[model samples]
Target: MAASIGSLLAEISGVEDPIEELQSLKTALLSIPVSALRDSVSGQRFDVIFSLLDSNEREQVELCVDILERILMALSPVNVVQNYRVELQGGLTHPKETVKILALMQIGRVVEHPDAVTEILNNHDILRGVIHCIGEEMSVAKQAVQSLSKLSHSKPGLDKLFQSDLLNAIKDVMATSDIIRYRIYELLVEISSVSPISLGYCANSSLISQLLSELTGDDILIRATAIEMVTALAHSPHGRQHLSQQGIMDKLSNMIRGAETDPLSSLYLPGLVKFFGNLAIMESPQQVCETYPAFLDKVFEMALDPDPAMIGVALDTLGLLGSTVEGKQILQKTGKKFKAVLLRMSKHGSLGATNLRVRSLDAISQLLTLLPEQQTEDLLALTESWFQLLSNEPMDMIRNIITQPFPELHCSALRIFTAIADQPWGQKLMMSTPGFMEFILDRSTGQTKEAKDGKFQLVGTLAGSSTAAEILGSQHYLRMKTYLREGPYHVTAVATVSTEGAD
Candidate 1:
């Protein structure tokens, strides 16, 4: 190992330019796992790394930092802490954001144990490094916050988190930027969600009250941001109970009720809609919609609006809402609103802005999709009803869709077909529709890798289902089974033997 480093240095010494030499070293070192390349690391390796770091060249310093993280990742946490504890601690406060994340991940991996938590508790530098990470970069901030939350799983760990040092650190960051402030709030909410005792610990700070109140703040954008953190808070029973007592409804009421009844006149907030929509899917879909009736009203209104942005958000929200069975049930209860949304979806699904068209197909697929186990007689009837009503010319429209030059649309439409391929009613429709079965059997139709996979998924779904054989008629079903056997991109191999005049 020493000889290898020696040879590397000897080779780079003759290079004409310093930066080129450093870059060459970096490239060579990266190609080899220098940290894990040997069974035992030599002290010369550390010396060479420190020498490079001290050179103060930006490229060399950056490479050293990255290499440190590479070493940290390659080693076990215990080995890292035991052998490179000083450098590991230095890495936690590294200027490069990715190194900070890698260092925090190392700590987070081991700190799940009580002893590890206690050990980290005593090391104030490591603790401060982790907290500083909370304000560094968005991705690192999340890692730091999550690492700190793991400490709260124990009493002493809880003390460390709620202590003046950590609180002061977070308080300092809260003063920097609104985004960083919310990062701190997000951490508190996470700790609070652990248990009732943890929630009580977080309550000692004024941040909790500030967070809940901001959920109803005058600025809608900030309110939406607050709701993102608070949504996680709602996952816990105590957290939900706290939100209820704190008047969560008061925070959301006005947002649901747009400024005007007229769809065009109303304020359109994609994030605001997503907040309520996601909460509904995660919690009680029916109850969330019922408590905030205007939530769906806005979604429907947005779907009907002419603005492409509104339509895009509406498509995304609808896709999310219709993904689960409970979500489907809630949509079903919307009656004509559901039908109107489906109607709008078909307009986009068949032809519109590229993204909206893709989203419409995805949403319809999600709405129609059901697992084999979840399919009851009622559920099958629901899916059939959904397919039959996507548009007035639902059958012919989709049939024409597959023939288009757009591969994305072709794939999305194929996904919709994949979603329904297992159901009895969907099979009946395919059987009755002329040339649909031929499209299913024809592998030549899929133009791209994604489209090929999509078509194969539909064929696989049909070939694997119990009822497809009987309902699709044994002959058509047999071809589908053959398609599945050959796989998505299969082409028949042809061989030819050519003979010259001599032969």
Candidate 2:
């Protein structure tokens, strides 16, 4: 932006090939010595270059950001960010997304240095500019969040962003759109994930508490929208403790309980169920269920709903609740009603919506699946009884599911079988089920690659289980082990002895 480059940038409007002219100017600008420009530069020269960056006359945005970055990089050698502080912050509010992105990135560079982080934070214009970028493009908003996060590392920087007038400015922008509000929450959660002190910073911002309040607020839509951020905050140990301490867990539980009678519950019930389900998995499934009986009741209620969207959410939550040893044990406590739900979904063609059916079987399989480390005698018996309750003959029922042409169902069913393949009772069912063992040995079936992998994994689990050798018999056990060693796609090479007089 000094006189030499400033004049070319200024005259570019008169040229027919402005892009080419800008590119050539950028190249020459890069060749000039940084010390020379820093000596001759003033704030007004920066204004000249920034005007070109903000120009609506030419649409060459990449050229503008590139030229600005080159000049900044030259100034960067001596940490002269304050020289063009006004223009760089002003760049954030420019209508173009590229300019906003460059401004956020340059601010990020300052935040990295502890000594200089406050230089950007102490300036009210730069703070406002950063908050203003949240409504811009996703790429730009993401950088803005990153820059804010970098500033949050130290005490003074954290105090300024969280407790100052800029916090109010952020809330005002958050009111602009759904996307922008979520981005602000993302920024808060990102900071909150750092430590309790960082979350305390978020708490001071009021936006964090505001978001949690909306999760139970009278507006059903706000409650639904706020659940996602709550789930995000729950990802950290401190956040979960924070949420639990604030009574949000109980408030959501009460909200869902009342939603059963609310006609508007359909709008938000799925998100609420998803949140508790994730909470159940993240913390203690048994503890969450014991603490909030209504939550699980709503999950099972949603499970059998006529609507696919609600039921899909229900099934996913059930799967998460069944993923751990404790989760599986608690789900087994639900007993007959849940098993009936699984049976209806297992009967393929009627519930032909592929995702719903896939999710159902996946949930059921996970509920019954027992890992070796987790397989106590009590759990083994629990899994075996649930399998039997699924149908008159669980083997035939699963075999039918396996016969379905859908590759996803096929893989999911095989996973179910893999889950039970190790149980002593499960092994006995396979022995007497006629071709069930043959099914394990047969290699000629035409199946998708995923199905083939599923079959191989089934054999692998069977071969690896402790009592398989005794229960499956030595010959069959050795063959399954061989199949495991051979890998999923292994093809047996048949030997052909050459005849003496063939030619």
Candidate 3:
């Protein structure tokens, strides 16, 4: 089977119609065993496989590199880390662009291997070869630089890749080729995932200035990718300030409001919403209100939108923003409108509708906590309505709302239920639901947010059977007891635990 697979790969690797053969070779390569590749002790056969590569012509070299990519991909994870380090150091100057390309890809494939990247970092020669290749045309340059960026950011003991000369290489490539600059955006995304700290490198190295300048470029991809990288950078304090300076949300909002044929609008909008929300949470709410009033209005428009997803983003943004004082007031003024929409949505809407309702509940919950204590009835009425819906709603929607944004809305809903039990009608409403006891038990003991005894003592206390159990559980149930020890503590305690689940 090994010999037949090798011969087939060889035949396809060197065929006249390289593209078609390359595709077939890629499919066949997946079936080949990595163990067989490592045990290729016949030097003659290995040489024959290597020589089949057409290294002289650009097109052929790319095709051959694609095949080698499949081979390396198959061998990855099983091949020893030291073998890759040795191959990469030796392949850097192997006199063929195709071979160097394959080496760069192999380096990336094995990047997660135990000590492979550490070896590359210690051996500066291989790193320099990768930097030199960054000047190649756009596609190859993108692949090489992205691998280098990932190594520099996430791979431990590879800080040496960020040395002065390599940094200069990234800048030079971005300066010349828009394609390479676009790749910078891709590389930054990978960098952010592995090590969010590396966004600072992109911001400080003048890449951010160039990227923001390119936002107005004719290339829609360049603009969209730039916005994405900028968002990742916004994860840091310095990056957030940089985003503000570039007026990123204004640019993104323009893109959102404008008509772009680009397919990335969906991708762009979610991140943009998240960035604005992060800014609203991190910076002063008054500052956000002062700075981007139109932005705030646009977000509110999204919350009341017909699309469930759009409404969800809008609600999440509002929730994040409502965590601030001025933002809370803004949400309060808009709450009744959003709540009406949510109540309408909950009637016959899909699972997403229920999820959006929970988000609305969370934002309203936050706003209520910030409201004046003497005037909390309006919010209390809305809370009562939401709890009633949760008790009688579909099982899936109830589970989704509880599990979706753990702890935040879950804790808020529990608080609202406890508040409702104080009223005679509220106590009667909760007791009418046959599933109420089972739902509470599921939430308290089934590894959901309420299971954390530290964060959710109230739920446990309300579920504990008798006075002695309540007293015993109450010792460690600080948050729960605090809710109990409040006004009408004794009157609400029995109603809180009333269960009609089973005999």
Top candidate by TM-score: 1
- 2 or 3: which has the higher lDDT? 2
Go through the candidates in order and give each one's C-alpha lDDT.
0.76, 0.79, 0.55
Q: What are the per-residue Cα lDDT tens digits for candidate 3 across 1-503? A: 55655666577647665556555555665565655654332221333334545356566556556655655555544352354455565555666766776777777656556555566656666767776667675555766766776676563523454445666666665576666566766665455444335655555566557767766667656665666666666666656655667777677666656534656555556656666677677777767655666556667666666777777777677667755556655654565664554454343232444455556665544433333232255555644554455435533444445555555445545544443433333434444656553454332333443434322343533433233233323343454344445422122333456569856
Candidate 3 collision pairs: 458-480
Q: Is candidate 1 or candidate 2 better by TM-score?
A: 1
For each predicted model, how many residue pairs clash, with residues at least 3 apart or on different chains?
Answer: 0, 0, 1
lDDT of 1 at 57: 59
- Each candidate structure's TM-score, on Cα atoms with residue i matched to residue i, is 0.82, 0.81, 0.50
Candidate 2, 1-503: lDDT as tens digits: 45666667667757655787787777777777766655434443445456666566555667878777766755552264566677777778788777888888888888777667757767888888888888788999899999888888877878888778888888899999877888898899989988999999889777788788777678777778888788889889999999989998888888888886899999988887877888888889999988999888887777777888888888888878877888777776788766766665555312568787788788777877777887788988878877777777778877787887788878887888888887777888888889888887787652678888889988888888898998989989988978877877878789999999899
Residue-level lDDT tens digits of model 1 in 1-503: 43555565565555433455555555554666656644423343453554455444577677665655554555555555656556658768666665677678878865785444556777878887888888787889989988888877888877887765877777887888888888888888889998989998888777888887776567666766787777778778798777778777545656566446534333336666776787787678888888888888888989998988888888888888888888888889889988988988988988777788888888888899999997999888988888889766576888678778888888888888888888878888888888889978886787699988888888889888899888988899889888888888999778987888755
Please identify model 2 stretches exceeding 4 Å from their true place.
1-59, 63-87, 113-118, 175-179, 345-350, 441-449, 491-503
Which rank order by TM-score, best down to worst? 1, 2, 3
Worst 10-residue stretch by lDDT in candidate 1? 38-47
Return the TM-score for candidate 3, rounded to 2 decimals: 0.50
Off by over 4 Å in 1: 2-39, 42-55, 70-117, 137-143, 149-155, 189-200, 235-241, 258-268, 372-379, 494-503
